[model samples]
Target chain A: MRTASPAPSRWALRVVGLGYLTLLLLAPLVAIFYKTFEHGLAPPIEAITSTNGLHALKLSLLMVVIAVPLNTIFGIGCALLLVRHKWKGNALIDSVINLPFAMSPVVIGLALFLLYGAKGWLGPDLAEAGVEILFSVPGMVLASIFVSIPFVVRETVPVLQEIGTEQEQAASTLGANAWQTFWRVTLPSIRWGVAYGVVLTTARVLGEFGAVSIVSGSRSGETETLPLYVKKAFDNFEFPAAYGASVLLALLALTTLLAMNVLKRKEDA
Target chain B: MGISVEGAVKSFGDFQALDDVSVEVPDGSLTALLGPSGSGKSTLLRAIAGLETLDAGRVTIDGEDVSTKPTQKREVGFVFQHYAAFKHMTVFENVGFGLKIRKWDKAKIADRVHELLNLVQLPGLADRYPSQLSGGQRQRMALARALAVQPQVLLLDEPFGALDARVRKDLRAWLRNLHEEMNVTTIFVTHDQEEAMDVAGQLVVMNQGRVEQSGSAEDLYEHPANEFVMSFVGEVNRLGEDFVRPHDIEVVLEADDRTEEGVVKRIVALGFEIRVEFVLGDGTDVWVQLTRNELQRLELREGQIAFLRPVQAKSFNGSTPSDPPGASTPQGSDDGGDAEVSAAV
Candidate 1:
């Protein structure tokens, strides 16, 4: 006589999975918070008010405001061109759009340095026009944009490809012009994907350090962003100031994550 | 408007999706493009909608050359296989989308949307989103959205393909009534033969990117232009000599002495006729047709021989010599080669 095999116990499996995830992910987050506030909120409070630290925060926030919307429009344009049209070197163009995601931010900063730095390509022309790029605010924004280019494009292209061209065709047959078809049918269809791209791009720009550091010059009140400011405090052996700035950065990251979750929930709803 | 497509051919890479296709959809008539998957019926419909650019041919709608014009200028309404209802919009908003795109007055769009929703029998469901409605209800909403713009032509690609059989049948009837009421030049593509025959006033049969035949439902059913159309339109049986309608048969059972001595083989209930298939004296198999009343009068069983003769003799298109012979076989036994020799007659 044959016998049936026993099924796995649900409670045992659930406990193992829950324990592993909590240990790996939740424990680190809890540790970070505990270490930051162990002494007191006074250190974190004092560090946030420093002139250089506050200026860094303001500059980083300003960069995000400019970079994210600019990248969103650029990403949408690239996605539309790559998916909707055919031209020579189209595959090459697509590959180049994804180049930033694979290349090191340090290498990107070096390439920008070559183009705009003194004694480099286009360096003389930029100097003649009196446009200071390297070691300036514009240089910092450009570096951030380079590192964050692929985030929005990567999120958007797959969505547009999956949605296909049928909806636009239908709208056109209904007497909608090209612009109307795009606005009424195509854009609305990919709004969620675009929002996702924006959130991802924003996260990337906020967390970026290497490329911005190389181009920003670390000037105390001018080009220095918050991540560089944290590094400066650590380099000077100011542990309290460094840890305090790190905590503030963590909070900003957490807030971004919460906003993304809320956006995702709305998309689901 | 009457729509005419002449010698239209469209190809995607190596696959000839629509090859030398010609169709004339009469004004105010509902025509069906009926074919199996990959038969190019959908391609033909897309070409008419100006969605697919043809390699060669012209499409004239209402005596105007629409072949070169863009789809936006064609004034056609298209219902997709997936309903393609805007998921983010309410039923009212979806129906009024085209009007809004055209920048119509707000009041005009609202009134027009209301009228279309009422036409599709979803009056109070206007505020409901597409996800909130059932499959059948969503299909109706999509139809209303297509019609709200008062297009000159309405095209549907397998509109009922996604529905269950019961819903499909009901929608077929509803679509036919709606077509008549609207009296627009409507063309719909369907793989369902019964749906095509029941819903369309005119039928265009396509196969392998080419048109095989075009005619009324009865015309194609009675006389198919080729074998594919014959086998496609309805269930048909092909025998060795000639094909015959079961209703045209007369069965006489051979009886000994005072009565018929043959036993019934199989009695098939065919709504109006009882089909009897049995063996004859020469050990030949034959089938006969009888009225239900006659079948009731004479108890039929297995192992019976039916002496059969024709009530009428008509040659059917796609009927080869292999089929035993139509009811009237002038030349004796409908065995093998004899059927094809006399097929032309």
Candidate 2:
């Protein structure tokens, strides 16, 4: 009755998953750090509090603070519209909502610039209203919002769909009004999903550069963000400064990831 | 509240879940919509409770047209088959959900929930969450929640279907007593015939998206309106009138010698049928059932003939009054209607 045990199929799947994860995720992250720290830490450490570096870092955090919350609200609205309403063209609307994910960030920034620039169609009217949008902090915020629109929406939609309308229906049948039902039932069910989406949006907003660079016009104190500081440090051949700022961006991303993990654990519970 | 569904029709994509179904549930009487699966019984129940919208027709409760009303406005208590007690809330909170949603005072909500829990025989389980309760206990909690609202009409959809057989039986009886005690207009759906007969004052049998029959359990069993209803309601042996119970026919031996008593042509045993065989005398070829010990004592054998006689019997059609059993199967029987029983001596 002594027989040898065969390897489980799951082990092969695990190996394949680990290999792909390492290649796609670990390799690129390690490469980023390797290139940044190759020259040593002094230059990078000094660059962290330097003039352009400080401006870029402060501007980037400010942009994320504004852009992430805006996108979070917009994503929740879009997800609710798509899931709860049976309006015509919902599919088309959903496809449009996802278009930002596929479109280039530069294209998004260029589109916003075209719309909000002084010479562009609506730009003159906006200028009359004393709204300086193009090549300003507003422009950078608008670009970040446009490019990060899909995260919260995509995260919340499937969870809302899976939770179904049953819980809300039960609440309604129990005599809870529409607002009460949403507050008590619908919101609680999708809170984790919304939290996950907001975290991802915050990450994308913090790391945004391509769109921000184009619309921001590299105004150091106002429009420039952390990623732009890294780019400026690299251009100036300040290797350690760029690497240190890169590490800071990496730390922000890690924080966002940690928040997402906590939220996901709560969702599982 | 009494509920009357008038010609309700509901369709889902292509399938007609309920097709022009109509039923009247009297006030304070526990009625059961008895049918096989997919017979639109649950659909009808949902329509009354306002959980489902009818494509056509109207549902009225207590003489008010509530067909278009939302579920919350209708004030109907619905108990789902899956004991849909709130998983996150304790029993007290679950039972108090209705009052809490309506913004009832805290003291009043607590007292009502406590009373309802006691009514459901779970007075001390108020602090326990639904996840901690057993199947029967969860079901009791669900009932308590439904009743706590003091809604006008109570709707239960297969309330006992998820429990084990033994537990289901006990719950079924307990529910009967609870219904009698509460006297709220109740309509429950179940496909089990025995459960319907034991619990419901009125039984509505459905088949293939239509109502086949509706009457008391005795009316349905003894006088089924159609062949489908007859076979679905209870077990019916398909034999000649003489072979059925209530028909008086002598059981005789199969031997050619002098017949001192009834004879048995062939002997076979089934669970309920202790000893059954075909009798040979009048060429009637009727089936017979005898006690196990009587067969062992009589030493009945095969291939024997004996004198046969019929005492009294009933005709399948009630057109003719009670007549003697040996009268004979008459001609011109319009349908396959026959007596429910044939007594064999």
Candidate 3:
């Protein structure tokens, strides 16, 4: 039933918002912290410091390191392309940039596997070139890149469109070449948008699980990122490590959210 | 350097923004492209600055044809209509942007920027962001930035258009003075006839994407090329099929050969001049402007019978002699020499 409260009180709206977030997000987060510490701090700390757990954490961070820059660069290029110029397929390309958001991350991982898997398309040629793709770090990195594709572009496009091209035109008329104009005028004008986008992209790359897990073959030590490792710990009855890693991941997500909020405030200012 | 647009034509979908528009700006001259909204004045200015690529036609800067040159290579200085100040950059940075792009020395750039800031009368505001400046100050800052690189020509799109009336007046005077000092071949787009006359040496009147006329203020006022130019430049009184300047109508007591008789409707004695309204036998209104001394000499009064002579009435080919409004697209067929609708019985 769609109960429409046409004129809900301000306090009622606030209560609804807070209650939903608390029930859905905060309660689970608090339970995870409680579950991790139920056997005292020693168990979670030991599990986290274990070689497999440390490797998973390192792998998650590595994914972020590799994927974030590539996406950021691609995103800025895409936003500029979508905003500044018009071509035959401009709208189509604009829609394609946000394809990752429309499709499931698991599907993205599967698509990458289909293209780069050992027996899939391009897999044999890649193998002949002595390069491993699917079930490897490269495949996982590709999935991370895919899931995080939309963040920088989605954030930057509106900002680019809002700033308009007059400043860029002015720069050009003032004798600044195209390259100079981009570095001096266009880049600085869209810096905040790009910054927020980069942060979102970093968060997405770090949090990407479904696609990376599928492509990574759920390897234990080498390809097991933090999210996959957390799922594995839970499945194997390692509750302390599972909850501890989940708490760690939640903290990372919280930090990313705080960063995004700060960036948003700065942009508004 | 002199700039010219030869047969510039631009279109957007079904709407033709510019249609075979052409104008010339002589060297070290200030010219204004005056047109109503959607008349392609800004488009013409942008074309000259190489901002908008022409579908067909060529824009020549000075003697050389720079039609295909990029905006940067054109060596032109262009100021946007809204004063598109780089919000992130300080005044110093904005003014020095061109010089920096041309690879000027850091110290030299600072010196040039300071000199420009002082030139635009914006001293001590180099470190201030554009947002900190008022509308008038921002316009001057935009002008200063455009002038910093010693460009061959300067183009501005409604430089003072956003300012209040008083600020616009002040900036207009400042711009005229600045143009005199710099002597760059400058062309600015404006819809205000007074602004075009006050600030530019020549005015190009445009209507419906076609150039109606291009001449000096006196030329345009005394002898407008068409109905568009005649009406666009200054106030004109319509009497039957004639477009008569109010100043050209003389009121006399006695009847004359070239005079039409009418009863005086009203006389408004403005401080310096007098405006007399009259109703002819057909009940058509005719307005005439006169100096206070002229009114005193003629002894004009309200509700008095008078004989009015049209000393310099013009009939444009734009408006049909029998049906005036029938010439809706008069200027559209003008380049073929349809002539202006002027002078009739």
Candidate lDDT scores, in order, read: 0.81, 0.79, 0.87
Model 3 chain A: weakest 10-residue lDDT segment is: A1-10
TM-scores of the candidates are: 0.86, 0.80, 0.88
> What are the runs in model 3 whose C-alpha is more than 4 Å off?
A1-8, B247-311, B318-345
Q: Which ten residues in a row have the lowest lDDT in candidate 1 chain A?
A: A1-10
User: After superposition, which runs of candidate 1 have C-alpha atoms over 4 Å from their true positions?
Assistant: A1-28, A86-90, B241-323, B326-345
DockQ of each: 0.63, 0.37, 0.69
Clashes of each: 17, 24, 10
Q: Is candidate 2 or candidate 3 better by TM-score?
A: 3
lDDT tens digits, residue span A16-128, model 1: 99999899978887876776677899876788788888898899888899899999999988888888887877799889988888999889988888888898898779989
- lDDT for B21 (candidate 1): 90
Best of the two (1, 2) by lDDT: 1
Greater TM-score among 1 and 2 belongs to: 1
**Candidate 3, residues A155-180: lDDT per residue as tens digits?**
89999999999999999998888888
Off-target runs (Cα >4 Å) in candidate 2 are A1-46, A49-55, A86-88, A118-121, B123-128, B237-345
Give the top-scoring candidate (TM-score). Answer: 3
By lDDT, who's the top model here?
3
